[model samples]
Target: MSDDMLRLLPWTTPDGKPCYLSAASDHSRLSLLADDVEAAQLDSGEQVLDGARAVLGDTKAGERAVRFALTRATESLEDVLRIAVSRGERIEAGET
Candidate 1:
């Protein structure tokens, strides 16, 4: 994967734990924490994996979504931070 893809979603672990991933030239991964279910609405490994596959999916689709959202090659770092914070808040609030 290119730097742009890395900057887009930023691979994470399945339990919402943050982890570094190699370039996604072939595959992509995201992690979720057990506690994220109460927030993000993703409860199981299957759910997490499915969600990742749906949203992140293959390179072409992922790149397209990112580009459409950001209207640029890179996803805004600030947006990523905001999303993380919002998800955390949702969990804390029991909104998920």
Candidate 2:
């Protein structure tokens, strides 16, 4: 299988484990599922960012709330980075 077919799973197992799958076609079941998950994650992240901004704008917002939002944003960013790096590496390697 080519590295280009490899995908970084958006979510972990029920027990909290990382998962990876590879498919020759993006239309495959696994690939579609991953796409759905990535879309969800991105949507959720956007919401989180909006919420964070609102909180930051509030004069009553506490440090704890800001910290929590930062933490979640960091996690979402990490997931995005993982996906980007995986795809970038595969492309750089010219996987076929």
In model 2, residue pairs whose N, Cα or C atoms come closer than 3 Å (at least 3 residues apart or on different chains), thus clashing, are: none
Global lDDT scores for all candidate models: 0.41, 0.76
Q: 19-62, model 1: which lDDT tens digit per residue?
A: 44235342333324322322343233335445455656555676
Per-residue lDDT for 1-96 in model 2, tens only? 364456667777899767778666667888788778788878888888898888889899899998998898888887777667656755765643
Give the CA lDDT, 0 to 100, for residue 31 in model 2.
Answer: 77
Clashes per candidate (backbone, < 3 Å): 12, 0
Q: List the candidates' TM-scores in order.
A: 0.22, 0.73
> Considering summed lDDT, which 10 consecutive residues are worst modelled in model 1?
34-43
Return the top candidate by lDDT.
2
